[model samples]
Target: MAFRRYLKPRVVPQEVEQIVDALPHHNVGSQGYDPWGLNLDTAKISFTAVRWLYEHYFRVEAHGLENVPADGRLLLIGNHSGQLPMDGVMAAYAIATNPHGPRLPRTMVERWFPTVPFLGNFINQVGGVVGDPKNCGKMLEREEAIIVFPEGIRGSGKPYRLRYQLQRFGHGFMHLAMEHRTPIVPMGIVGCEETMPSVTNIKPLARMLGVPYFPLAPLVPLPAKVHICFGEPMHFPDDARDEGEVERRVERVKDAIRDLIDQGLAKRRGKF
Candidate 1:
């Protein structure tokens, strides 16, 4: 009994076979039928795997999902961490594996993300778009839920000592929200900072290689329970367009996320 208790959870063979069986459905996007290059079948399969990690490994529990509207132009802004961008994966997973049904969130990634050969191609198949104003506006128009990390590369690659400490969020998302009049939902993801701890950023080497941040973390991430809390959707009137006004609204979102993060952190039993 003790040995069984310590054994890793069994990987369901049926689910794995189901995902493998659907590979043929991936034909939909191989020809670029969708501008975003998203293959719904592929996404479903990918989420199946991600859901396994979320359920058994991280044991992620997403709160306040109802706060997100069922249908509308939505922007999900959040804190990013886990040098591997697993925080983003977990956040995406939280939305994708909703109790009702699977709903993959359209995530915006750095431009350099798609330049990494096979990794880049996989990202495209699973609906990770390059971060840019044009791409964002288009996605919002499609009424898709987009997950944006305003902290960008900084949030993902910050030093281990500074984990959970938010960095400055750029003004792009703020401007996008106001322009499209889309509701912005702030999400705070806890436990990622502890999962993939970064020792330091190799700034010079990262820059030399044209990467945003080259930080060192364990070869495999540690198991950490993740909590994703979604704040109520915040509406920004179309009237606010000035730079100063935009900055203030951006701060409001950041403040909202910070508060949510604190709330999530307070609930941890063993900081797991």
Candidate 2:
């Protein structure tokens, strides 16, 4: 759905509220994380927000969560869908409230997000840091679980007609996993693309409105049921040191996610 508003942009809290309203509702004050030696409360809020989104806004049916390790610096690489970042939110929610227990996963967010008043505060409070190489390395060194969508913006912004094809992922995440000897866990998120069938992009309009990007969808409020599937953890040999090997492993993980997305899509389709 195309959202064109001509109202004057409000300031601070109001602006934040407007942004939040434009997307899904979340519980912003519940979970947190410790990164860069800074004990930020934003992580907890982010966790809570995601949990609230699953509990209230979206009907999420998660499977194969037993595949996630209970602890360590694990990398979760997944397919990014939806015009917005709701797919990430749904995955975060599944991890936090796994039937096994409460475990918070820290995510790397874009640097630009935190500069937008309350939105920035909210992101930081939820343990989301700038997607800088230095910060990502630091988090890995600390043995914290990290979630990355290596496709950058492409996976999240693909045209509706091209849903499910894995985008070209940056090698940073694979490099980090090899360096830290962390396992790469693959996650597949379904239904978000159907929620908002964003088929086109209006970049100039987005810039004029001071937003990152604007999407055109067939539905205003997406009613698609969301599903998240976690694949078996894939481990890299601690002594493995070849760059080509790393790339191959990353592709394997990507392939697994694609399969899961297909499975999820089929499962949801069968139910109807």
Candidate 3:
């Protein structure tokens, strides 16, 4: 009991503990774990560790968080960059700390992530789920908020020259939104592109590692000030049929994200 007390305070400071404890956890079992593998204790520790990066290091500025619904299933779609998943981390932090309604949004991670030993379980404990449609559907059915990067590796592995220019978005998110009748909150993330700009990708290395792409970038992300703007919630009719209709809906969300990105870029004073 003494050891537990010592470990908890050291790993999770009182301030960080309060911040995490304030988050609305839904469907959590008596053991502090949800069906999707979210462990409340694990989440508290992870949040405490990342709080420094989100607050002082990156100095993330979030706007339009009021637009995110205080309750109900939500889809937070955004552009991906930084040669890593830091953009998703910052966005999730912003939403989790939002004064209006603090909630831990589940982030959809790449399939390759689960193939890595230990990393997969660590991710799941911190509220990350494999980017599978079936899993996402189940979460939505339970009225959970999810963060999705439709650009996938294409955006994250893009060269520095293509930074801020969103890559092609997959239509799967649109299809899910339409089917679930969930509100889509378009998010624009800036500064992450410069955090660890990739000059090129080594396909051979990526193939050997069995990952999407191996980026030629810094080992650690530079502390680039990040800006995350959440746009007004967008809704699509559930009656959509045909691929073209879904594509059109996806395009609309992309446009909204693009506009928000432009705004964030304009508002940015410096990269670091």
Candidate 4:
């Protein structure tokens, strides 16, 4: 009962309906299974709930929607935080609610995430797939929007003290961008670091559960306000295939996200 205090006020029903009414309506998966097996009907229905959670409960305020390409295949890379999946959902919801046509990203969820009962199925129903190269490449080839956390499990598990400190990123995303001639959109998520504020990892328990680091945090997430900032889209030549070049590109993207994080944190005035 004490943890109930952490729950934020939900969005008014009327407002949620109004926002849903205003969302862009088009058959994204009508032709067939979207890049990942996303069901258009399911995604639209899920969007309604996500909208409430994103705009009303979490009160996520987004900046730089203009930077998100209004169209085309895109790779969204950002820092992954929060002991739970709230950060990813907020990021995904933020993109989905973009007033500029609401581009719902096909997020690349970790393989383990899909094994979590209902939560995993809901993710898949709305276009989330295992973060496999083949799956990602297929999506890129189809020119679908993709959101990736290069930091992977490690980023989401760092101690609370290391919150918002960007983790080392893998270079695969850059290679994919170059191969597909798709642009990379670097994004930064603020306030998520303190959602549960992991103090330690219960390693043995986590291993037994077959999950990554188990965050030892409060029973409920703190009502931390969330902010998502999208950096300018970056492009790599499709023909550039040098390993060294890919590493440099990956670093450059990481630096851009770091800058955005600094700016967002400054804007947040150290609330968390």
Which model is ahead, 2 or 3, in terms of lDDT?
Answer: 3
lDDT of 3 at 10: 77
Candidates in order have lDDT scores of: 0.79, 0.69, 0.91, 0.78
lDDT of candidate 2 over 1-272, digit per residue (tens): 01112221322234333333332112222332233322222333233445556766677899898988867678888888677778777787677666664355667776667777877655655556677877777777766777888886788778889888888988888777777788888988888877677778889997887766678866464757888899988877655467777688778888899899988987785321
The CA lDDT at 106 in model 3 is 95
Better of 1 and 2 by TM-score: 1
Candidate 3: TM-score?
A: 0.96
State the lDDT at 77 in candidate 3.
Answer: 99
The window of 10 residues in a row where model 2 has the poorest summed lDDT is 1-10
Q: Output candidate 2 Cα RMSD.
A: 8.4
Q: Between 2 and 4, whose lDDT is larger?
A: 4
Worst 10 residues of 1 by lDDT: 1-10
Comparing 1 with 4 on lDDT, the higher-scoring candidate is 1
Mark the regions of model 3 whose C-alpha exceeds 4 Å error after superposition.
1-7
Q: After superposition, how far is residue 130 of candidate 2 from its true place, in Å?
A: 1.5
Q: Write the per-residue lDDT of candidate 4 for residues 34-97, one digit (tens) a residue.
A: 4356654455556667776776767788899888876678999999988777777888777766
